[model samples]
Target: MNKKLCLGAFMRPISLHTAWWRHPNAAPQANFDFPIIKDLVRKLEDACFDAVFLADHLAVMNMPTNALKRSGTITSFEPLTLLSALAACTTNIGLIATGTTSYEEPYLTARRFASLDHLSSGRAGWNIVTTVNTEAAYNFGLESARLHAERYERAGEFFKVVTGLWDGWADDALLMDKESGIFFDPEKIKPLNHKGKYFSVKGPLNIARPVQGWPVIALAGASDAARQMAAESADLVFGNARTIETARSFYKDVKTRAIAAGRNPDHLKILPANQVYVAATREEAYRKKQVMDDLVHVDSNLPNLSLKLGVDVSGFDLDKPLPDIPETEQSKGHQREWIALAQREGLTVRELAKRAAGSGIGEMIGTPSEVADQMEEWLLTEACDGFMMVFHSAPDGYDDFTSMVVPELQRRGLFRTRYEGGTLRDTIGLPRPDSRVD
Candidate 1:
C-alpha cells in the first residue's frame, strides 16, 4: 500500500505573512470576514484537506505599537467561535481550534470542544496550547507570563482533568426512553472528581461523551517539555522544522518518545508548517514570494523577534552579529532555532529578524509539480506525515494550491482524492478512543 498524506489548512489570521493584507490582490480585512473564511474552508474541503486549523491569540498587544499597527492579524474572530460557525458550514473538513490551558477553565474548554464534536458530527479537534505571548498574561490578569515549564506542567494536569470530564458518561449511557422517563442509564455515568495542582475540575461534564470519545487532541511546539506532552497525549503534532534533516530528527525523537510512553507511533501524526507559493512557473513563485517579503517593514520585525527569543533585541545593533543571548521564560525550542539560524547563516540581527518574519518553517516556492516534489519527499522520508499549509495571500494563493498542487499530489497517489469517512478520526485514520468511564 502507498503512503498517504494528511493536509491541513491554516485558516485563522488568514495568512502568516506580515504583509498579507498589503498584497495587491489580497482580500481587504480577510481575517475578520466570515464570508472569506467560509469560502476558504469550502475550498479546503472540496480539495479533501484533512482539517482547517485555527490559531488563537489572547492579546493584540503582543508586539510594539508600530509593529502592531502594521499587522494583518490584529483583529480576527476567536478560534472556537469561528470553528463552531465553520462547523455549521463545513461537513468534511475537521475543525481544530487552539484552546490555551494556562488561561482557560478545563470544564469550559472540554464542554466547548465536546459541543463542537457533536455539532460537526465527530469532526472536531482541540489544539492544546500553553499561551506564550507575555501580553496575553496581562489580558488574563496575570502580572507576568508563567514560566515555560510551569505552563506545560499546568497543561499536563489540565489535559487529565478535561479528558476525565469527557469520560463522564459511557458511550451507551444516553437513551431517551420516554415511557420510563429515564434520559440516561444512571449506572453508566461516572464523575472524574479530579484534584490536580493547577485545576480541580470535578467531573461529569454537562454534555454527553463527545462523538469521537474525546475530540482529537492536537499539540504544537518543539521543546523537550512539549515533545513529552505530545508523546503522551497528542494524536497530532503540528511541527516547526525547516529542513528535512531537522524534520527527520524531530520525527524520530518524538515517535521514539511516544513508543516509550506505550503509544503506537502511527497514532501520532507530525505535520510541519509550510508557507507555499505555487504558480505557473518556478520563477513566478519566487517572484510572488519576493513581492510579499518586500512589503514587511523592519520596525515590525523587532518585537516579533523579541517575542520568539523571550529577550529584548531592541538594544542590539542591527548591523552586528547577534550577541550571546541568555534564554528566558519563552519557548526554548523557538529561541534555539533563531539563534542557530543567525549563527549558521552569518546573518546580522537585521537580516535575521527579516528572514524570521518572512518564513519560520520555510517556504515552498515553485510550480505545482515542484512543490509536490518537496512534499512527497518529506512524506516518503518519514520526516513528516503531511503539512499544515500556510498561504501567502488570500483567494489567489488559496485558489492556486487547491486547483494546482492538490491535483498533482492526487495524481501521484500521495493524497486522498475523495473523503474516506465522515468523522475527523475516521478521515485521518486515527482510531476512535474508547470511553474511559468503566
Candidate 2:
C-alpha cells in the first residue's frame, strides 16, 4: 500500500447551489470563463492537492422538462476542453476528466486520453463512467439508453480494447537508430483485433503509448457493474458515500473483490465524496449553509430528482411520505445513500428535500477544527483512503477551503505539505506501466 491520502475536488463550475449565481460573491459566468478554471487549478496545486476531477456525461442530465428549464447547472463547457486548459496552467496536480465507455469508441477514447497523458506528461487520468442517463442515448442519436446490465457488459469489453490498444506499440518500436537505417521495428508493433459484443476494433491506436502505459483509470462507484469494473480494472474508485461505516464496507468490498479477481488489493484506492461548508465558528458555518439553502429553488429541483431517482416525486406534498417509488431489489446506491442520511437523522421528507438540492452529497458544516475532526476520523479509521471535495461556490468556495480547511488537514498530517512529484502517476505512486509488447 502507498500509505498516502489522495485529495481531489469533485469540481463543478460556479456552484450546484441553484441561487449560487445570484450570490453577491459568486462568479455566475465562470463555467465558460477560461481564467476561472486556470485560477482554480493553480489554487489546488498551491494547496498541494493531488488532482482536480471533473465528472461528465455525453448529454444533458435527463431532468423532466420543467426542471430542465429552471436549473442553473444545466449546461457548461466540455470537460476535456476545460481540463486541457487546466493542464497548461499547472505543473504537478493530476487532471482527471470523465469519459464513458458506454457511448464513446474505445480507440477514439484511447487516443484522446493518450494525447492528454502525453500533453500533461502523464498527469492525466480518465474517470470511467458507464453513463447512467438514458436521455444521453437519445441525444447521441441512439434510439434509447442501453439496458442497465448491458452498459456494464459493454464497459468490460471497452476496457480490454482500450488497454489492448495502448499496448499496440512497444516503446522500442520507435527505433530511432541512425546507423541501422531502420527507423522503425515492425516486430515490436502489435495490432489488437478486438472483437466483442459492443465493439470490434482492429490495429494499433493512432497515437504512441501514453507515458503512463495506460493513463490512470478511476471509476465512479455505484452499481455491481461498477464494483466489478473497479475490481478488474480501475486504479481508483470514487465511492459516493455519506458515512464512515458505508465507506469502510465499500473499501473492504472492493479490495476483496480485486484480490479475488487476481489483482493487488492496493491497486484500488477508496475515495468517498464529501461536501464542505466551513466558517470561523460552527454557528457561522450553519449560517452559511442556511444562506446557501435559502438560495436553492425547490421547484427547479423536484423534477430533476424525480427522473434520476426513478421516483415521480412531483405531485407529493413536500412534507408528505414518499409514494410510488419503484420496486427494485437491485441497489440504487445513491438513492439508498440519501435514504440512509434521512433515516439516520430522523429527518422529514421536506428536510431531506432541502439538503438534497444544495449539493450532490451530505454536508459537513462547521469550523475548520470541526470539519477536520470528521475528516481525520474518516481517513484514520480506514473509512476512506481520501476525499473527493465538493465546493459550495467556484473560486470563493475553493479559496475558503484552501485557506481554512486545508491548513487544518495539513496540521493533522492528513494531506500533503508540498506536492511530492511531477506527474500524476508519481503522486499516485504508480510506476509507468510497461508496454505489453515489451
Candidate 3:
C-alpha cells in the first residue's frame, strides 16, 4: 500500500492570526454564527480531510487588558456543543473537541464522548487538555492554578477512569432479542469499581459501547510528562515546531516512547501544526502575509510574548536582540522554542512578538504546488505523520486550501481523494478498540 498523509483542520471560532478579523474579506463575528461553522465543516469533509479539531479555552486568553480590547480574541462557543451541532450537518469527518481533565469529572466526560460517538456513528474524538491558562482558575473559583505536575497526575488517573467507564458494557452485550424479550446480556456488563488518587467511581457506562469501541483520544503537549501520556494513551498526538530538525527530533522521541510503552509506534500519529499562505505565486503569498503582519500592534501583544518567555521583553529595545532570560516553569516547551527561534533568526523583541502573534508553527509561503512539496518532504522525511492546518481565515482560507492545495496533494498521491471509511478511525487506519468487558 502507498503511504498517505493524514490531514486535520484546526478549527477555532476566531482566526489564529491576531489581525485576521481586520482583513477586508474577513467575516466579522463569525465565531458565533452557526451557519458559517456548518458550512466550514462541510467544506473540510468534501475535501477528504481526516478530522476537524476544535480548540477550546475556559476563559479568554488575554492577559494584558489592551491586547484583549484591541484584538478580536474574546468570543467563542463552547466546543462540545459546537461539535455536536456540526456532527448533524456532516459525516465521515472526525469531530474532535477539546476537553480538559483539569476542570471536568471523568464520568461526565466519558458519557459525553460516548454519546457523541453514537451520534456521529463513531466519528467522535476527544482532544485531552490540562487547561494551562492561569486566568481560567479565577473563573473556576480557585485562588490559584494547580501545579503542572499535579495536574498531569490527576489527568493520568482521570484517563484511567474514563476509559474504564467506556468498557463497562461489552460490544456484544447488546442483544435486542424481541422473542426472548431480552434487551442485553447481563453477564456482559461489568462495573468499573475504580478508586484512584484523583477520582473514585463505580460505573457501568449508561450508554451502549461506542461504534469504534471508544472515541479516539487526541493529545497536544510538548513536555516530558505530556509526551509520556501521549505515548501511553493517545491515538493521535498534536505538536508544534518551528523547524524540520526540531520536528524530526520530536517525532522520533514520541515514537520511541510509544515503543517503550509497549505499543506499535505506527499506531500513534504525530501531526505538528502547520500554517500556509497559498496564492497563484510566491510573491502574492508573501504580500498576503505582509498585509496581516502589518496589522499586528506591538504594545498589545507584548504581554503574551512575556508570558511565553517567562520574562518581560516589553522593556527591551524593539530593534535590539532579546536578552537571555530564564525559562518559564509554566510552558517550558514554548519558552525553549521561542528562544531557539529568536537565536536562529536573529529576531528582535518586536519581530519575535509579531511572528508569535501569527502562527506558532512556521509558515509556508508559496503556490499550491510549492506548499504541497514542503508537506510531502516533511512526511517522507519522518518529520511528521501529517499536519494540523492552522488557517489564517476560515472558509476563505479553507476554500483556498481545498481548491488549490488539496488537488495538488491528490495529484502527487500524498492525500486521499475520497472517504475511505465510515468512521474517523477507519479513515486514519487506527484499529477499533475491543471492549474490556468482553
Best by lDDT: 1
RMSD of each: 1.2, 2.2, 1.5
lDDT for each candidate structure: 0.89, 0.77, 0.86
What is model 1's C-alpha RMSD? 1.2
Q: Lowest summed-lDDT stretch of 10 residues in model 2?
A: 322-331
Off by over 4 Å in 2: 1-3, 64-66, 178-180, 327-331
TM-score attained by model 1: 0.98
**What is candidate 3's local distance difference test score?**
0.86
What is the overall TM-score of model 3 with all chains considered together? 0.97
Better of 1 and 3 by TM-score: 1
Model 3 misplacement above 4 A: 310-312
Q: TM-score order of candidates, best first? A: 1, 3, 2
Question: What TM-score does each of the candidates earn?
Answer: 0.98, 0.94, 0.97
lDDT of 2 at 305: 54
Clash count, predicted structure 1: 0
Give the Å shift of residue 402 in candidate 2.
0.5
Q: What tens-digit string does per-residue lDDT give for candidate 1 at 1-438? A: 378999998888788888888889999689999998998899999999999899998988566788888888878999888888888888799999999998999999999999999999999999999997778999989899989889999999999889888888899998899999998997888888888788776768889999999898999998999999999999999987877888999999999999999999999999999889999999999999899889988777888788767788999999999999897777888888788889988999988888867656667889999999999999999999999988888888898899999999999999998998889999999988888776
Error of 1 at 39 (Å): 0.5
In terms of lDDT, the poorest run of 10 residues in model 3 is 325-334
- For candidate 1, which ten residues in a row score worst on lDDT? 355-364
Residue-by-residue lDDT tens digits, candidate 2, 1-438: 224577887776445566666566877777667787688778888998888888775776666666566566677878877887777778888989898877899988999899998888888899887776767788788886677787788888888899899999897788878998988888888899888787899978778888888888899857677788888888878887766788888888888888999987766677887778899999998888788778777675676455435566667777765544563422367766766676678765666676667765646889999998888877777787788887787776788789999999888777778877667877876666778896
